[model samples]
Target: MQKLYSQGSRLDVSMPVIMGIVNTTPDSFSDGGDFFSTKHACDHADKLINAGAGIIDIGGESTRPGAALVTEEQELARVIPVIEYVSRHHDVWISIDTSKPAVMAAAIAAGAHMINDVRALTEPGALAMAAQLQVPVCLMHMQGQPQNMQANPEYENIIHDILTFFKARIAACIAAGISFDNLVLDPGFGFGKTLTHNYQILAQLAQFAVLDRPLLIGLSRKSMIGQLLNRDVEERLIGSVSAALIACQHGANIIRVHDVAETMDMLKVWQMTQTQMIKQN
Candidate 1:
């Protein structure tokens, strides 16, 4: 079993945990503008928590491909209220999905338990800010900026390159005073990869455990599932849940997803089967 410590709270990853996605942006790839307001976002977060989500990931800016940049003030306004509301009402963990140092700090002050940076904290001052916050940080790997990530994504060896990136980021985080137990790693699917690259990462997802950090995978209703199954965003629920089950089998520790209830149901069944297998063995 692996344990992740955040703000003096502990999360046991003996089984895969669900990190529910709550996009407060107007242009996210899926469910954008659905929870744009603080009340709506908090309501959606309540549903996710009721549905067995262990973490609620609140994102202000959309990092979707071809997405534009949002100002720091705008981003803060979008997410801080939601974080405050959830923190005040619920006892669940809150993860702030941002790559900006200021946003990270503000979110932490607003009662966020974790930092989920799509840029892997490569942005200026992000690493130091996370270290200073002393909370669990998820470092995701993206080959390029959000605006042009998918324009022409390429890699000599996708898995190797991602592993190398995680290694360097882990070293940087440690040097900046973040403890190893407070770190999580995410191989950014759909961030800067072709269909082939995305599938390749999924197939070899377990290899990431070598980093000795919890792995967070976000594959809910993504273009990878849509493109593969010929389904639209709203129509990709089955594919999304199936992909999440596959990720759990491949040793994903945290599954970041849009369909929280469905994913939690699948994980319950998967956990039951694993327990049976262990007993039989």
Candidate 2:
């Protein structure tokens, strides 16, 4: 069992936990315009929690391929109100998905429990800000910026390179006064990889467990699933849930997803089957 300690909350990751996505941006690949407003975002978050989500991941800016960046003020205005509303109403963990230091600080102050940075805290002042916040931080690996990440990503060895990247980021986090236990690692599927690269990372995800930190897998409604199954964004719920189950089987600690209810149902079934198998063995 793996445990992640945030400000004063402890998350048990012995079984895969669902972190439901609530994109406050209008440009996220899936469900972008659905929750752009504070009331709608907060309402959607409540629905996710009712559907069995342990964490609500709120993102103000879209990191989708070729996505344009938004101003810090715009990003803050988009997410802070939603975060404040959800945190005030619910007892669940709220994760702010941003790489900007100011947004991270303001979100934490507004009641976000974790920082899910796609830049892996490498953005200016981000590492120090995360350390100062003293909350759990998820560091993701992206080969390049979102605007051109998928243009032509190259790597001598995908898994090796990602592992190396995580190791260095872990070292940086520690040096910045963040505890290793307060860290989570994400392989950034579809962030900068081809279909082959994304599948390879999924197949060898267990290799990341060597880092001795919790793993956060976010493949929900991503292009990797759509491209593989020949499905559209709204039609990829089955593929998204299937991919999430695969990640759980491969030792992922947290599955960040869009379809919370469906994913939670699958995880429950998988957990029951695994328990029965263990009993028989």
Candidate 3:
């Protein structure tokens, strides 16, 4: 259960790791267009590291609701250069937020350390490629594609259904050659969940512990925070960090966020409290 993601050469996650979000696309829900340029993307990544992000999650595609798809060439064009640039320069762990096997392969060839596939390697040949590449893969549970997943999102039983999906995927990965140690799971908040379902999963997040894999929660400045606080993406930092703290307190091993410094600061305070409780105990 102890494995490092390629993003930071992070061989450990017994404590939480702050994964900084770097969207090279022009349309991500948060921090889009801010680092569309390669230099800007690398600069922002360095900033995140200085702010306490252990991993730099770079994505070229926009998975936000109703966002049109970018062609593979466009996607590759957007992400590969950034990946190559950072791989050569930074000592940080580099994760390519891609679903295409071709892109994943190319990114790996270019020196990407982890494959954070939103599709959970469900894309054709993606699982096999990841298995062959033998990198840590984070399986995300998305109810439907980004196109219309939110249209009528319904879960027979949110937690059970997500666990079932993860179980099957984990089996397939093992069958293909990925080890449990190299696997992580994310419930794909806001990817398809209703606001109610989102909180329900968070409330029951610890249930995933039974699977015995590292848990990754990405509630950073998402719609869940926005809808909960009636705030926009630009103003959801407090709610976002609060949700991250709750997830970490429960059982999350990793938090993917847009605000790395703030999350780390909050985690420091949280660590102090936990230490006090332990001493008192």
Candidate 4:
């Protein structure tokens, strides 16, 4: 079995795993204010754990396009209590999603097991802080800041550019004393990509396996599904689950999603069939 170790938490990744989303922001594109309170967030984490999520990803700021940035203090306030609660109550791994150095430090200090930075640790002091924390860090590629990323995104060659970006970020992480084993890669599906770009990434997700790091995909309930199917947020469950399964088939090791129970059920059936196919072959 493939194992990912972070701050004493070891995860089995031989098959794709689910990382449930717990957004504590009021403006997140999906389920924004649903878990904005500490009590509510803790309850949601409990539900996700019961649903078989291997990791609980808690985010304070909303990274949706045109979203406003939150203060470091506000971000800390939103996620720390939940992290403390989950850490004390659940045995599951906890991922702190933030690009701020201080927030990263505080969250880890408060008992988060890993870091998931959308800015790829490019923010000031972020890379260094991550290196010092010595936890699994997910480096995601984004074209620009959330506020203006979707304004007019473009690329010379989408796959080539994203691969190059990952290479550089990987090199930077290694140079900063973070071992290669402690790194994960995210393609940032809806952060800055258009509908075509998103689909192209999904279709070619297997190409990212060449990086040798586990790929973490987060396309659940994103605009790609919404725009393609003309479904609202509450109606994109099927599309999100389908996209997640496609990503897993394409070599994704971790799928970050909002609907944990449905995703868990889908993976169970998919894994059973895959096991039977291998046995027959």
Candidate 5:
């Protein structure tokens, strides 16, 4: 059984946990303008909680490939209200998806329980700030900045490089006074990988488990699904859920997704099947 200790709360991750995506930005790759408003975002959070989401990941800025960056002020304005509303109204854990130290501090103050950074706290002062906040921090592996990451991303060996990056980041987090148990790892699918590269990581994802941290996977309706399946963002629900189930089978602990209800249903089926198999054996 896996458990993540957050600020004043505990998240049971023994089963595959769902971190529902709530992008409050207007330019998100999928469902961009759908929840850009605080009311819409908060309402969506309510729906996600009811649909069996273990965590609500609220992102103020769009980190989609080739996406423009927002100011700290803009990010704060976009997410704080929603975080506060969710925290006030729901019993669910809130994860702030940002790499800015200021945004991390502000989100936690406004009621965020975890930090899900695409840049993995590589920003100046981010590591120290995360240590200070002492919340469960998910360190992701991105090859380059979002704007140009997909332009011509390359790796000597994709899995080996990512493993190296995670090792270094884990060390850095612990050295900065962050508890080893308070860390999570993400492979950053589609952030800087080609279609082949993405599948390679997915096939070998269990290798990351050797790091001894909870593995957080975000493969929901990403371009990898769209491009591979030749489907649009709105039409990738089935593909997204399929990939998510594959990731869970490969030992993913936290499955970050946009379709909470569908994903939850699939997880229920998977869990029950596994249980029945164990009993039979």
Candidate 6:
């Protein structure tokens, strides 16, 4: 069994887990316009909790390719209330998905348990805020900003680039007084990689375990699956599940996903079969 993940609160990372995505955005490529209202967001959070989500990651901004950036005030307006509502109502762990330090601090003040920063806390002064808050933080690796990330994806060595990025970010977090166990790594599946780069990253995930941090793979209904199967966002459940299963098999500790029920069912069945297979072996 692996060790535990203390993202905000302590998570028994003895086994693979699923973290459900609750997008408060109006333009996310997947599950956008789905959980936009307070009532709807709260309802969706309940559904995800019932579906076996170990954590609920709420995001206000859309980091989708070429997605417009939301101002700090706008982002706070969008996510703080939702985080507050969930924190006040639910006993489940809450993850705030934001890159801005202002929003991160505000969310932390609102009782968010984790900070899932797409920039890996490289944004100046962000690491300090997270350290000050003393919360678990997820550092995601993206080649560039969201506005022009997909314009031209080029990399001499994708694995090397990702590792270097993680190393720098992890070092910064450590220097900022954040505990090592409280830090998580995200490969940024669809942040800025090409279709080929995305597949390559997913296929060779073991390379990332060198960083020795809990790995998070958020490929739920991402463009890589959409391109692979030529399916729309609504039609990519199986592909997303398959991708998540592959990621877990290749050493991913957590999977951030929109399709919580299906992913949870798959995880239950997969775990049971793994137990049987291990016994037979």
Q: How many clashing residue pairs appear in each of the predictions shown?
A: 0, 0, 4, 0, 0, 0
User: Each model's TM-score?
Assistant: 0.98, 0.98, 0.96, 0.99, 0.98, 0.95
Per-model CA lDDT versus the true structure: 0.92, 0.93, 0.88, 0.94, 0.94, 0.86
lDDT value, residue 74 of candidate 1? 97
**lDDT tens string, model 4, 185-242?**
9999987788999999999999998998898999999999999999999999999999
- Please report how far candidate 2 places residue 33 from its true position, in Å: 1.3
Model 5 gets an lDDT of: 0.94
Q: Which portions of model 1 miss their true places by more than 4 Å? A: none
lDDT of 1: 0.92
Off by over 4 Å in 2: none
What is the per-residue lDDT of model 2 for residues 1-281, given as tens digits with 9 covering 90 to 100?
78887768888987889999999989888887899988899999999999999999999999999899999999999999999998899989999999999999999999999999999999899999988989999999999999999998999999999999999999999999999989999999998999999999999999998998999999999989999999999999999998888899999999998889999999999999999999999
lDDT of 6 by residue, 1-281 (tens): 55443334567666787898888889988777888887788889889988888888989999998889878878887788888887887777889999888888888888788899898888888888888877888899998889889988899999899899889888888888988878889999988899999999999999988887888889999889999999998999999999999987898888999888999888888889989999999
Considering TM-score, which of the candidate structures 3 and 4 is the better prediction for this target?
4
Weakest 10 consecutive residues of candidate 2 by summed lDDT: 1-10
Poorly placed runs, candidate 4 (over 4 Å): none
